[model samples]
Target: MRFDDIDARMRVFETNHDHCVLPGLYIVARIDGRSFTRLTRERHPFEAPYDPRFRDLMLETVQHLMNCGFQAIYAYTQSDEISILFHPNESSFSRKERKFISILAGEASARFSLSLGDVAAFDARISLLPSQNLVIDYFRWRMEDASRNCLNGHCYWSLREEGISAGDATQQLKGMSNPQKHDLIFARGKNFNDLPSWQKRGSGVYWQEVSVSGVNPMTGQEKNTARRSLVTDIELPLGEPYEDLLASILLDGVANRSPILEDVK
Candidate 1:
Protein backbone atom coordinates (compact mmCIF):
# COMPACT_ATOMS: atom_id res chain seq x y z
CA MET A 1 0.00 0.00 0.00
CA ARG A 2 1.04 3.62 -0.53
CA PHE A 3 2.17 5.89 2.34
CA ASP A 4 -1.12 7.78 2.45
CA ASP A 5 -3.09 4.53 2.53
CA ILE A 6 -1.02 3.21 5.43
CA ASP A 7 -1.43 6.49 7.31
CA ALA A 8 -5.21 6.35 6.95
CA ARG A 9 -5.38 2.87 8.46
CA MET A 10 -3.15 3.91 11.32
CA ARG A 11 -5.37 6.90 12.20
CA VAL A 12 -8.47 4.70 12.28
CA PHE A 13 -6.92 2.34 14.81
CA GLU A 14 -5.43 5.18 16.83
CA THR A 15 -8.67 7.04 17.43
CA ASN A 16 -10.87 3.96 17.94
CA HIS A 17 -11.18 4.64 21.63
CA ASP A 18 -13.97 2.90 23.56
CA HIS A 19 -14.13 5.55 26.26
CA CYS A 20 -13.88 9.32 26.48
CA VAL A 21 -10.29 10.65 26.46
CA LEU A 22 -10.28 12.93 29.45
CA PRO A 23 -8.36 16.21 29.45
CA GLY A 24 -5.35 16.60 31.73
CA LEU A 25 -1.76 17.83 32.10
CA TYR A 26 1.48 16.42 30.73
CA ILE A 27 5.12 17.03 31.68
CA VAL A 28 7.69 16.96 28.90
CA ALA A 29 11.35 16.60 29.71
CA ARG A 30 14.13 17.42 27.21
CA ILE A 31 17.82 16.89 27.94
CA ASP A 32 20.89 17.93 25.93
CA GLY A 33 24.66 17.68 26.17
CA ARG A 34 26.56 19.86 28.59
CA SER A 35 28.92 20.73 25.79
CA PHE A 36 26.18 22.98 24.36
CA THR A 37 26.60 25.30 27.30
CA ARG A 38 30.35 25.60 26.90
CA LEU A 39 30.00 26.35 23.22
CA THR A 40 27.21 28.90 23.67
CA ARG A 41 28.99 30.67 26.49
CA GLU A 42 32.05 31.03 24.27
CA ARG A 43 30.19 32.28 21.19
CA HIS A 44 27.77 34.85 22.64
CA PRO A 45 28.91 36.11 26.02
CA PHE A 46 26.79 39.23 26.30
CA GLU A 47 23.44 38.15 24.89
CA ALA A 48 23.57 34.75 26.54
CA PRO A 49 20.41 35.15 28.54
CA TYR A 50 18.00 35.92 25.69
CA ASP A 51 20.03 34.76 22.73
CA PRO A 52 17.89 34.62 19.60
CA ARG A 53 20.03 31.96 18.00
CA PHE A 54 19.58 29.53 20.87
CA ARG A 55 15.89 30.39 21.26
CA ASP A 56 15.36 29.71 17.55
CA LEU A 57 16.87 26.27 17.90
CA MET A 58 14.53 25.45 20.80
CA LEU A 59 11.59 26.99 18.93
CA GLU A 60 12.22 24.64 16.03
CA THR A 61 12.09 21.72 18.42
CA VAL A 62 8.81 22.96 19.93
CA GLN A 63 7.47 23.47 16.42
CA HIS A 64 8.24 19.85 15.75
CA LEU A 65 5.97 18.87 18.65
CA MET A 66 3.23 21.17 17.33
CA ASN A 67 3.43 19.62 13.87
CA CYS A 68 3.01 16.22 15.46
CA GLY A 69 -0.49 17.45 16.56
CA PHE A 70 0.12 18.61 20.12
CA GLN A 71 -1.83 21.69 21.17
CA ALA A 72 -1.33 24.54 23.65
CA ILE A 73 2.33 23.70 24.01
CA TYR A 74 4.30 26.12 26.17
CA ALA A 75 8.07 25.67 26.03
CA TYR A 76 10.71 27.12 28.34
CA THR A 77 14.47 26.70 28.23
CA GLN A 78 16.86 26.42 31.13
CA SER A 79 20.08 25.93 29.23
CA ASP A 80 19.92 22.60 27.32
CA GLU A 81 16.75 21.15 28.80
CA ILE A 82 13.33 22.35 27.61
CA SER A 83 10.06 21.79 29.46
CA ILE A 84 6.80 21.82 27.54
CA LEU A 85 3.16 21.78 28.67
CA PHE A 86 0.63 20.15 26.33
CA HIS A 87 -3.13 20.19 26.34
CA PRO A 88 -5.07 16.93 26.58
CA ASN A 89 -6.48 15.06 23.54
CA GLU A 90 -3.32 15.37 21.46
CA SER A 91 -2.51 11.87 20.24
CA SER A 92 -0.28 12.56 17.26
CA PHE A 93 1.94 9.62 18.12
CA SER A 94 -0.70 6.98 17.49
CA ARG A 95 -2.35 7.63 20.86
CA LYS A 96 0.30 5.53 22.53
CA GLU A 97 1.81 7.41 25.47
CA ARG A 98 5.15 5.70 25.24
CA LYS A 99 5.33 6.25 21.49
CA PHE A 100 4.64 9.96 21.87
CA ILE A 101 7.35 10.35 24.47
CA SER A 102 9.89 8.40 22.45
CA ILE A 103 9.16 10.29 19.26
CA LEU A 104 9.71 13.65 20.94
CA ALA A 105 12.85 12.46 22.66
CA GLY A 106 14.34 10.96 19.53
CA GLU A 107 13.63 13.99 17.37
CA ALA A 108 15.07 16.39 19.95
CA SER A 109 18.17 14.28 20.50
CA ALA A 110 18.94 13.97 16.80
CA ARG A 111 18.33 17.64 16.05
CA PHE A 112 20.51 18.92 18.87
CA SER A 113 23.29 16.46 18.16
CA LEU A 114 23.44 17.55 14.54
CA SER A 115 23.02 21.30 14.98
CA LEU A 116 25.11 21.96 18.09
CA GLY A 117 27.78 19.28 17.97
CA ASP A 118 26.44 17.80 21.20
CA VAL A 119 24.29 14.85 22.10
CA ALA A 120 20.77 15.43 23.47
CA ALA A 121 17.90 13.39 24.92
CA PHE A 122 14.20 13.80 25.72
CA ASP A 123 11.63 12.17 28.08
CA ALA A 124 8.02 12.98 28.96
CA ARG A 125 5.30 12.08 31.48
CA ILE A 126 1.62 12.90 31.83
CA SER A 127 -0.28 13.91 34.95
CA LEU A 128 -4.04 13.79 34.74
CA LEU A 129 -5.98 16.14 36.97
CA PRO A 130 -9.65 15.86 37.85
CA SER A 131 -10.06 19.61 37.81
CA GLN A 132 -8.40 22.78 36.55
CA ASN A 133 -7.50 23.66 40.13
CA LEU A 134 -4.81 21.04 40.18
CA VAL A 135 -3.29 22.39 37.00
CA ILE A 136 -3.24 25.86 38.49
CA ASP A 137 -1.57 24.60 41.62
CA TYR A 138 1.11 22.82 39.64
CA PHE A 139 2.00 25.94 37.68
CA ARG A 140 1.95 28.03 40.81
CA TRP A 141 4.50 25.71 42.30
CA ARG A 142 6.75 26.18 39.29
CA MET A 143 6.43 29.95 39.39
CA GLU A 144 7.28 29.97 43.08
CA ASP A 145 10.29 27.88 42.24
CA ALA A 146 11.26 30.41 39.65
CA SER A 147 10.88 33.23 42.11
CA ARG A 148 12.84 31.50 44.85
CA ASN A 149 15.64 30.55 42.50
CA CYS A 150 15.68 33.68 40.43
CA LEU A 151 18.93 34.89 41.92
CA ASN A 152 20.76 31.78 40.88
CA GLY A 153 19.50 31.63 37.31
CA HIS A 154 21.78 32.22 34.33
CA CYS A 155 20.16 35.48 33.26
CA TYR A 156 20.43 36.83 36.76
CA TRP A 157 24.10 36.05 36.96
CA SER A 158 24.73 37.74 33.62
CA LEU A 159 23.02 40.88 34.82
CA ARG A 160 25.13 40.99 37.96
CA GLU A 161 28.29 40.64 35.97
CA GLU A 162 27.24 43.74 34.11
CA GLY A 163 26.91 45.63 37.44
CA ILE A 164 23.12 45.58 37.79
CA SER A 165 21.81 45.80 41.35
CA ALA A 166 19.69 43.12 43.00
CA GLY A 167 16.87 45.52 43.83
CA ASP A 168 16.72 46.90 40.32
CA ALA A 169 16.82 43.42 38.92
CA THR A 170 13.86 42.30 41.02
CA GLN A 171 11.83 45.17 39.69
CA GLN A 172 12.42 43.91 36.17
CA LEU A 173 10.59 40.65 36.71
CA LYS A 174 8.00 40.53 33.89
CA GLY A 175 4.86 39.28 35.59
CA MET A 176 5.21 39.63 39.37
CA SER A 177 3.34 42.86 39.86
CA ASN A 178 0.48 41.71 42.08
CA PRO A 179 0.85 40.77 45.70
CA GLN A 180 -1.36 37.74 45.10
CA LYS A 181 0.69 35.01 43.43
CA HIS A 182 -0.95 33.09 40.61
CA ASP A 183 -0.53 29.66 39.07
CA LEU A 184 0.54 30.52 35.52
CA ILE A 185 4.27 31.01 35.10
CA PHE A 186 5.82 33.46 32.69
CA ALA A 187 8.31 32.32 30.07
CA ARG A 188 11.20 34.49 31.15
CA GLY A 189 14.43 35.55 29.36
CA LYS A 190 12.80 35.97 25.96
CA ASN A 191 13.80 38.96 23.81
CA PHE A 192 11.72 40.91 21.30
CA ASN A 193 12.17 38.49 18.42
CA ASP A 194 11.64 35.51 20.71
CA LEU A 195 7.99 36.55 20.92
CA PRO A 196 5.50 35.45 18.30
CA SER A 197 6.25 37.44 15.08
CA TRP A 198 3.24 39.73 15.49
CA GLN A 199 4.23 40.88 19.00
CA LYS A 200 7.51 42.45 17.86
CA ARG A 201 6.16 45.88 16.92
CA GLY A 202 5.00 48.63 19.31
CA SER A 203 5.16 48.49 23.11
CA GLY A 204 3.07 47.50 26.14
CA VAL A 205 0.46 45.04 24.84
CA TYR A 206 -1.07 46.49 21.65
CA TRP A 207 -2.71 45.10 18.48
CA GLN A 208 -1.88 45.66 14.80
CA GLU A 209 -3.09 44.64 11.36
CA VAL A 210 -1.41 44.09 8.02
CA SER A 211 -2.89 45.67 4.90
CA VAL A 212 -2.75 43.23 2.00
CA SER A 213 -2.64 45.89 -0.75
CA GLY A 214 0.78 47.41 0.07
CA VAL A 215 2.52 44.24 1.22
CA ASN A 216 4.37 41.83 -1.05
CA PRO A 217 1.98 39.92 -3.30
CA MET A 218 3.78 36.60 -2.97
CA THR A 219 3.40 36.66 0.83
CA GLY A 220 -0.36 35.96 0.56
CA GLN A 221 -3.42 38.10 1.38
CA GLU A 222 -2.81 40.81 3.99
CA LYS A 223 -6.18 41.81 5.42
CA ASN A 224 -5.18 40.24 8.70
CA THR A 225 -5.15 41.73 12.18
CA ALA A 226 -3.50 39.85 15.01
CA ARG A 227 -3.41 40.43 18.74
CA ARG A 228 -0.10 39.74 20.39
CA SER A 229 -0.05 37.65 23.53
CA LEU A 230 1.06 39.41 26.66
CA VAL A 231 4.64 38.57 27.55
CA THR A 232 6.50 39.36 30.77
CA ASP A 233 9.82 41.19 31.00
CA ILE A 234 11.21 39.30 33.98
CA GLU A 235 14.94 38.90 34.51
CA LEU A 236 16.73 36.04 36.20
CA PRO A 237 18.91 36.20 39.30
CA LEU A 238 22.48 37.41 38.91
CA GLY A 239 25.62 35.23 39.04
CA GLU A 240 24.02 31.82 38.57
CA PRO A 241 24.23 29.37 35.70
CA TYR A 242 21.01 28.54 33.90
CA GLU A 243 21.57 24.82 33.93
CA ASP A 244 22.01 24.66 37.68
CA LEU A 245 18.80 26.51 38.30
CA LEU A 246 16.92 24.18 36.00
CA ALA A 247 18.31 21.15 37.76
CA SER A 248 17.19 22.47 41.11
CA ILE A 249 13.64 22.77 39.84
CA LEU A 250 13.28 19.59 37.80
CA LEU A 251 15.68 17.11 39.34
CA ASP A 252 16.09 18.09 42.96
CA GLY A 253 12.67 19.27 44.01
CA VAL A 254 8.89 18.86 43.67
CA ALA A 255 9.08 18.10 39.97
CA ASN A 256 10.65 14.79 40.85
CA ARG A 257 7.42 13.55 42.34
CA SER A 258 5.57 10.65 40.74
CA PRO A 259 3.37 11.54 37.80
CA ILE A 260 -0.26 12.11 38.81
CA LEU A 261 -2.74 10.43 36.49
CA GLU A 262 -6.42 11.09 37.16
CA ASP A 263 -9.02 9.38 34.99
CA VAL A 264 -7.21 10.02 31.69
CA LYS A 265 -7.41 7.21 29.18
Candidate 2:
Protein backbone atom coordinates (compact mmCIF):
# COMPACT_ATOMS: atom_id res chain seq x y z
CA MET A 1 0.00 0.00 0.00
CA ARG A 2 1.11 3.54 -0.65
CA PHE A 3 2.21 5.55 2.43
CA ASP A 4 -0.58 8.10 1.87
CA ASP A 5 -3.16 5.35 1.76
CA ILE A 6 -1.80 3.78 4.95
CA ASP A 7 -1.78 7.12 6.79
CA ALA A 8 -5.36 7.88 5.79
CA ARG A 9 -6.52 4.49 7.00
CA MET A 10 -4.95 4.92 10.44
CA ARG A 11 -6.24 8.46 11.00
CA VAL A 12 -9.91 7.46 10.81
CA PHE A 13 -9.82 5.77 14.20
CA GLU A 14 -8.78 8.97 15.94
CA THR A 15 -11.09 11.31 14.01
CA ASN A 16 -14.14 9.11 13.86
CA HIS A 17 -15.38 10.11 17.33
CA ASP A 18 -14.57 13.82 17.15
CA HIS A 19 -17.42 16.23 17.84
CA CYS A 20 -17.64 19.99 17.47
CA VAL A 21 -19.84 22.55 19.24
CA LEU A 22 -22.29 24.31 17.01
CA PRO A 23 -21.64 27.98 16.38
CA GLY A 24 -23.70 30.84 17.92
CA LEU A 25 -24.01 29.03 21.23
CA TYR A 26 -22.04 30.29 24.21
CA ILE A 27 -19.17 28.20 25.61
CA VAL A 28 -18.29 27.89 29.29
CA ALA A 29 -15.43 25.67 30.32
CA ARG A 30 -15.38 24.42 33.90
CA ILE A 31 -12.10 23.06 35.17
CA ASP A 32 -12.03 21.38 38.57
CA GLY A 33 -9.18 20.08 40.65
CA ARG A 34 -9.05 16.30 41.16
CA SER A 35 -8.69 14.73 44.60
CA PHE A 36 -8.09 18.18 46.01
CA THR A 37 -9.17 17.12 49.48
CA ARG A 38 -6.31 14.68 49.64
CA LEU A 39 -3.96 16.97 47.78
CA THR A 40 -4.61 19.96 50.05
CA ARG A 41 -5.08 18.07 53.30
CA GLU A 42 -3.13 14.88 53.83
CA ARG A 43 -0.47 15.43 51.21
CA HIS A 44 0.16 19.16 51.66
CA PRO A 45 -1.51 20.22 54.89
CA PHE A 46 -2.89 23.46 53.51
CA GLU A 47 -5.11 25.33 55.95
CA ALA A 48 -8.48 23.66 56.17
CA PRO A 49 -11.56 25.01 54.39
CA TYR A 50 -9.68 28.02 52.96
CA ASP A 51 -6.07 29.05 52.70
CA PRO A 52 -4.56 32.17 51.15
CA ARG A 53 -1.70 30.21 49.65
CA PHE A 54 -4.07 27.71 48.08
CA ARG A 55 -6.42 30.44 46.90
CA ASP A 56 -3.51 32.34 45.35
CA LEU A 57 -2.41 29.23 43.55
CA MET A 58 -5.90 28.80 42.14
CA LEU A 59 -6.08 32.48 41.12
CA GLU A 60 -2.72 32.31 39.41
CA THR A 61 -3.89 29.23 37.56
CA VAL A 62 -7.09 31.02 36.50
CA GLN A 63 -5.10 34.00 35.27
CA HIS A 64 -2.87 31.74 33.22
CA LEU A 65 -5.85 30.06 31.55
CA MET A 66 -7.42 33.39 30.62
CA ASN A 67 -4.22 34.59 28.93
CA CYS A 68 -3.19 31.26 27.40
CA GLY A 69 -4.64 31.81 23.92
CA PHE A 70 -8.31 31.13 24.70
CA GLN A 71 -10.85 33.88 24.07
CA ALA A 72 -11.93 33.79 27.70
CA ILE A 73 -14.03 36.79 28.72
CA TYR A 74 -14.51 36.06 32.42
CA ALA A 75 -13.05 33.54 34.84
CA TYR A 76 -14.13 32.50 38.34
CA THR A 77 -12.38 30.36 40.93
CA GLN A 78 -13.49 28.95 44.25
CA SER A 79 -12.46 25.95 46.28
CA ASP A 80 -10.12 24.44 43.67
CA GLU A 81 -12.57 24.85 40.82
CA ILE A 82 -12.49 27.28 37.89
CA SER A 83 -15.21 28.34 35.47
CA ILE A 84 -14.33 30.36 32.35
CA LEU A 85 -16.65 31.99 29.86
CA PHE A 86 -15.37 32.11 26.33
CA HIS A 87 -16.54 34.61 23.79
CA PRO A 88 -19.49 33.28 21.85
CA ASN A 89 -17.86 33.88 18.48
CA GLU A 90 -14.58 32.28 19.36
CA SER A 91 -13.59 29.66 16.77
CA SER A 92 -10.57 28.16 18.38
CA PHE A 93 -9.97 24.51 17.49
CA SER A 94 -13.01 24.95 15.29
CA ARG A 95 -15.15 24.74 18.46
CA LYS A 96 -14.27 21.11 18.99
CA GLU A 97 -15.53 19.93 22.38
CA ARG A 98 -12.81 17.35 22.85
CA LYS A 99 -10.14 19.87 21.94
CA PHE A 100 -11.31 22.37 24.56
CA ILE A 101 -11.66 19.70 27.21
CA SER A 102 -8.24 18.13 26.58
CA ILE A 103 -6.23 21.29 26.13
CA LEU A 104 -7.82 23.19 29.00
CA ALA A 105 -7.48 20.30 31.39
CA GLY A 106 -3.84 19.94 30.41
CA GLU A 107 -3.15 23.65 30.72
CA ALA A 108 -4.78 23.97 34.14
CA SER A 109 -3.12 20.85 35.47
CA ALA A 110 0.32 21.88 34.27
CA ARG A 111 0.08 25.47 35.49
CA PHE A 112 -1.30 24.56 38.92
CA SER A 113 1.16 21.74 39.53
CA LEU A 114 4.10 23.93 38.63
CA SER A 115 2.84 26.77 40.78
CA LEU A 116 2.31 24.50 43.78
CA GLY A 117 5.60 22.62 43.31
CA ASP A 118 3.66 19.37 43.50
CA VAL A 119 1.88 16.99 41.20
CA ALA A 120 -1.78 17.91 40.86
CA ALA A 121 -4.40 17.37 38.19
CA PHE A 122 -7.62 18.91 36.93
CA ASP A 123 -10.56 17.85 34.75
CA ALA A 124 -12.32 20.05 32.22
CA ARG A 125 -15.77 20.06 30.66
CA ILE A 126 -17.62 22.43 28.36
CA SER A 127 -21.14 23.74 28.85
CA LEU A 128 -22.91 24.87 25.68
CA LEU A 129 -25.46 27.47 26.72
CA PRO A 130 -28.15 28.51 24.27
CA SER A 131 -29.10 31.93 25.63
CA GLN A 132 -27.76 34.86 27.64
CA ASN A 133 -30.22 34.16 30.43
CA LEU A 134 -28.91 30.64 30.89
CA VAL A 135 -25.38 31.98 31.09
CA ILE A 136 -26.33 34.29 33.91
CA ASP A 137 -28.15 31.49 35.66
CA TYR A 138 -25.11 29.26 35.35
CA PHE A 139 -22.87 31.70 37.19
CA ARG A 140 -25.56 32.42 39.72
CA TRP A 141 -25.72 28.71 40.47
CA ARG A 142 -21.98 28.56 41.03
CA MET A 143 -21.99 31.59 43.31
CA GLU A 144 -24.80 30.11 45.38
CA ASP A 145 -22.71 26.98 45.64
CA ALA A 146 -19.82 29.06 46.86
CA SER A 147 -22.00 30.52 49.56
CA ARG A 148 -22.99 27.06 50.71
CA ASN A 149 -19.40 25.87 50.64
CA CYS A 150 -18.30 28.85 52.68
CA LEU A 151 -20.79 28.09 55.43
CA ASN A 152 -20.17 24.37 55.45
CA GLY A 153 -16.40 24.71 55.46
CA HIS A 154 -16.44 27.10 58.39
CA CYS A 155 -18.80 24.92 60.35
CA TYR A 156 -16.82 21.77 59.70
CA TRP A 157 -13.50 23.35 60.52
CA SER A 158 -14.87 25.00 63.62
CA LEU A 159 -16.10 21.65 64.84
CA ARG A 160 -12.75 20.07 64.12
CA GLU A 161 -11.03 22.76 66.14
CA GLU A 162 -13.21 21.77 69.07
CA GLY A 163 -11.87 18.18 68.97
CA ILE A 164 -14.68 16.85 66.81
CA SER A 165 -13.59 14.04 64.54
CA ALA A 166 -13.80 14.56 60.80
CA GLY A 167 -16.49 11.92 60.41
CA ASP A 168 -18.56 13.34 63.23
CA ALA A 169 -18.24 16.86 61.95
CA THR A 170 -19.39 15.79 58.53
CA GLN A 171 -22.31 13.92 60.00
CA GLN A 172 -23.34 16.78 62.25
CA LEU A 173 -23.60 19.22 59.37
CA LYS A 174 -25.02 16.79 56.82
CA GLY A 175 -28.66 17.44 57.72
CA MET A 176 -28.20 20.87 59.29
CA SER A 177 -30.02 23.80 57.78
CA ASN A 178 -28.19 26.85 56.49
CA PRO A 179 -29.55 28.88 59.38
CA GLN A 180 -28.39 26.30 61.84
CA LYS A 181 -24.95 26.28 60.25
CA HIS A 182 -24.80 30.04 60.55
CA ASP A 183 -25.78 29.76 64.20
CA LEU A 184 -23.12 27.14 64.77
CA ILE A 185 -20.43 29.42 63.43
CA PHE A 186 -21.93 32.38 65.26
CA ALA A 187 -21.79 30.45 68.47
CA ARG A 188 -18.08 30.11 67.80
CA GLY A 189 -17.94 33.95 67.63
CA LYS A 190 -17.51 34.25 63.84
CA ASN A 191 -20.24 36.01 61.92
CA PHE A 192 -21.10 34.61 58.51
CA ASN A 193 -21.76 38.08 57.12
CA ASP A 194 -18.31 39.25 58.14
CA LEU A 195 -16.45 36.49 56.30
CA PRO A 196 -14.32 37.53 53.36
CA SER A 197 -16.42 38.18 50.28
CA TRP A 198 -14.17 35.99 48.22
CA GLN A 199 -14.75 33.10 50.60
CA LYS A 200 -18.50 33.45 50.35
CA ARG A 201 -18.99 34.37 46.71
CA GLY A 202 -15.76 33.31 45.04
CA SER A 203 -13.65 35.60 42.84
CA GLY A 204 -14.05 36.84 39.29
CA VAL A 205 -11.55 37.87 36.63
CA TYR A 206 -12.43 39.98 33.63
CA TRP A 207 -10.84 42.43 31.23
CA GLN A 208 -11.17 46.17 31.65
CA GLU A 209 -9.71 49.25 30.00
CA VAL A 210 -7.62 51.44 32.28
CA SER A 211 -5.61 54.56 31.63
CA VAL A 212 -1.85 54.25 31.91
CA SER A 213 0.63 57.08 32.07
CA GLY A 214 3.88 56.74 30.24
CA VAL A 215 6.98 58.80 29.49
CA ASN A 216 8.26 59.02 25.95
CA PRO A 217 11.93 58.11 25.65
CA MET A 218 12.64 60.18 22.51
CA THR A 219 11.26 63.60 23.57
CA GLY A 220 10.81 63.25 27.38
CA GLN A 221 7.09 63.85 26.95
CA GLU A 222 4.47 62.34 29.23
CA LYS A 223 1.50 60.60 27.72
CA ASN A 224 -1.58 58.81 29.02
CA THR A 225 -3.01 55.81 27.21
CA ALA A 226 -5.76 53.28 27.70
CA ARG A 227 -5.00 49.57 27.70
CA ARG A 228 -6.95 46.40 28.24
CA SER A 229 -6.05 44.64 31.48
CA LEU A 230 -7.45 41.79 33.52
CA VAL A 231 -9.01 42.82 36.80
CA THR A 232 -9.65 40.29 39.57
CA ASP A 233 -12.64 41.00 41.76
CA ILE A 234 -12.70 39.22 45.08
CA GLU A 235 -15.72 41.18 46.21
CA LEU A 236 -18.60 40.14 43.97
CA PRO A 237 -22.23 41.16 44.32
CA LEU A 238 -25.19 38.83 44.70
CA GLY A 239 -28.86 38.45 43.65
CA GLU A 240 -30.04 40.77 40.91
CA PRO A 241 -26.82 42.76 41.08
CA TYR A 242 -24.76 39.75 40.05
CA GLU A 243 -27.17 39.00 37.25
CA ASP A 244 -26.73 42.54 35.99
CA LEU A 245 -22.98 42.21 36.15
CA LEU A 246 -23.13 39.11 33.98
CA ALA A 247 -25.51 40.82 31.59
CA SER A 248 -23.07 43.67 31.09
CA ILE A 249 -20.24 41.26 30.43
CA LEU A 250 -22.30 39.37 27.88
CA LEU A 251 -23.21 42.66 26.23
CA ASP A 252 -19.56 43.53 25.76
CA GLY A 253 -19.06 40.29 23.88
CA VAL A 254 -22.31 40.10 22.00
CA ALA A 255 -23.28 43.71 21.33
CA ASN A 256 -25.83 44.26 18.55
CA ARG A 257 -25.83 40.56 17.80
CA SER A 258 -29.45 39.64 18.52
CA PRO A 259 -32.04 39.40 21.23
CA ILE A 260 -30.80 37.18 24.05
CA LEU A 261 -33.65 34.68 23.81
CA GLU A 262 -34.12 34.76 20.04
CA ASP A 263 -32.15 31.57 19.50
CA VAL A 264 -33.32 29.65 22.51
CA LYS A 265 -34.25 26.05 21.94
The lDDT for every candidate, in the order shown, is: 0.43, 0.88
Question: Judged by lDDT against the true structure, how good is candidate 2?
Answer: 0.88
- Across 105-130, the per-residue lDDT of candidate 1 in tens digits comes to 77776776566555545555444555
lDDT of 2 by residue, 32-132 (tens): 99999899999899987889899889988988888788788888889989999988988888889999999999999999999999999999998999998
Worst 10 residues of 1 by lDDT: 198-207
What lDDT does candidate 1 reach at residue 151?
29
- Backbone clash count for every predicted candidate, in the order shown: 9, 0
Best by TM-score: 2
